[model samples]
Target chain A: MTVFTLINISLLAILVATALTVSRLRALYEAAMLSALFSLVTACLFVLLDAVDVAFTEAAVGVGISTVLLLGGLALTRSREAVTPRRRRLPGAAVAILAGGTLVYASQDLPAFGSADSPVQRHPLTDTYLHQSQEDIGIPNTVTSVLASYRGLDTLGELLVVFTAGVAVLALLGPLAHPVDARRRDDLDLVDYRVLRVISAMLMPFILLFALYVLFHGDFGPGGGFQAGVIFAAGFVLYGLVFGLDKAQQVVPRVVLWALIPFGLLLYLGVGVVNMLLGGSFLDYDTLSSDPAAGQHLGILLVESAIGITVAAVMTTVFFSFANRRATR
Target chain B: MIGTHYVYWLLFALMMIGLYVVISHGNLLKKLIGLTLFQVGVFLFFISIGKVDGGSAPIVSDDVETYSHPLPQVLILTAIVVGVATLAVGLGLAVRIFETYGTVEEEDVLERDTTP
Candidate 1:
């Protein structure tokens, strides 16, 4: 066996261990931490599977943002899970086993792992995307080209889903209210840690800069608006965690977030409308510039920037909303 | 054959474990965690299917002769972000439910509603 296969098996073993442990934990806080670990391991597995972009995203969203969100949710609710009665557990187990058995029975026909003869590998569309994207979109990253240009409509839909989630959360939780007194709270911010404060302050600019780097570097590398936006929001989340939500709010006011939340999606839609006006179908980037490649590049850059803006804004808004509630309470 | 298929079986095990957690857990937060686990399992399964034995990542490089399928990665990439969005909404609802019901336990909320 190759070294990569060995590593893959080991990581999968670790994932299984973590998942089992997480399922058994009744302490919600420990469970949250373990879930973060699960994400980290899964990100490693993604790397082994040659999905670098996915690995980057899972690390950022699953480990960083999801953990913080889970912790924030824990702060608002109980930290311990209530014991499920033994009588109630049996049916769930039975159902899960039956479902899994059916899946396993069906999976017997699946192609062997990593076989080049698999239907996914042999599909004509895969060949076209891998080769034609170079000539058609002029990007080194097929994933970015496919996501931004070829399947652009799907991405727009995904962005709308994210925007809708932000709006839904806002409606459910209310807007992030400014803390009445920013300076009065002891428990809200980590006021006593001078070392953490100094480090976080130093790291803030680099974090935002790196986020921008990831945003622009996506054409040739394993990043794009989604990962960049999450990293960008994570920087603010770190700031809020250490300094205070009040301070973070000052850095990015709710008014700005409210505007930004929809602006990104509108910008994306506006681009499609422009495409239609320019005598192309919706989201057809070929007509944006004299050269088709240049048009694709410009269109992708604009669309990715829009995605980055909306994702960052929505993430920050959600974090602020959760933190604001705790502060006010 | 069993050796080649072990990964699928393992993934199925992981997925089933998640399903079991989601079904059996009473706490709203635990259920969300289970849902995430299930989502990640599915994501892994997709990525696994896209893998090519001797291929590198999908980034266009002159030196790499073969590349893994980029389509599944693109699909899962969107799914991951959408998954987090769904989680955020779910958490928001959980918090809201806790606020109204004064507990996040499913049985307690049901009992309170039925008793009243």
Candidate 2:
């Protein structure tokens, strides 16, 4: 077999193995770790499939932030999953198998994998985005152009969704409403690990710097607002995991996050409003500058920064809400 | 030809396994794990469909003539973020359920609720 085929087979095997192990493991911690491993493997698969951008995101958000959030949730409850009754397994299995069988059979009709003439590759939008984006949006990354310029409205909606999720978690947890209780401050500190503390302190600046790089360099590379924001939040999460939630909050207080989150969304909306007022359609960055290319660059930068701010704040807010709730319990 | 298409079968199997786990598990966290796996299965399937047999990554460059479809990558990127968001919300609810019921198991929570 060719090397590419071999690599694909091995990665697929690892993914399946990880999934099986996660399902069978009773310990939630082990399962969480395995799930992170699964994400890592999936990221590699994305890489193998020539999707480096997705791989970058899968690695950062999937493996890093989500794993931390899962662990945070696990902290608030028991580590061991209760034994499911055996009788409960049959119907779900049958239904799942039925669905699986239908899909597998249907796959026979799918165009051969990676065929050049596949419908997706042949689509007009694909050609437009791939060829015309350079002239219209003036960005090297077509994904960035398509995401920010072509589908700006969808992305704006997604930002609002992330904002809503942050709000919903805050409502559920009710931690942000109350300040960090001074009396319970001692209960949350984990100062014992001098090594972790020192390392996180050393790495925090670089992580934040890297987040900035990802945010700004998105037009030229795989990094973007979503990935940058997650990385930024992850830096704080690491700090929180090592030091304390209250300490991390001091670095980014709830009030600031609450204000900044909405502000970021407003910034995005404001950009579109300006575009409309400038005699262009909403989110039409072509009118933002004397030259349309320069306008695209400026508009994408501004909007991406907005997204970055909102996403970072939302993620950090959600993390704090969960972490604080765990502490109080 | 069948060998070339084995990827779909394996991915489908994984999807079913994930769905079965979600359905059969009593623990809310296990359900979440299964849900994530299911999502990943979809992601893999989408990414697989975008690949060109001898294509390179879709970054605009001088040397690469054929590249994988960028649309799926863009779609999947958003989907991944949304998946994590949904997972976060679900986990938050799970935590609340655990707090109220004193257990993460669905049947146990149900039993506790009906009794009260």
Best by DockQ: 1
Cα lDDT of model 2 by residue, B28-51, tens digit:
988998999999999999999999
Would you list the C-alpha lDDT of every candidate in the order shown?
Answer: 0.91, 0.86
Q: Candidate 2: where is the Cα deviation over 4 Å?
A: A176-188, A326-329
C-alpha lDDT of candidate 1 relative to the true structure: 0.91
What are the runs in model 1 whose C-alpha is more than 4 Å off? A176-186, A327-329
True contacts kept of 1: 0.82
How well does each candidate reproduce the native contacts, as fnat?
A: 0.82, 0.67
Worst 10 residues of 1 chain A by lDDT: A176-185
- Report the lDDT tens digits of candidate 1 across residue range B58-95: 99989999999999999999899889988999999999
Model 1 misses residue A271 by how many Å? 0.7
* Candidate 2's DockQ: 0.73
CA error at residue B28 for candidate 2, angstroms: 0.7
Most accurate candidate by TM-score: 1
User: Candidate 2: lDDT of A125?
Assistant: 83
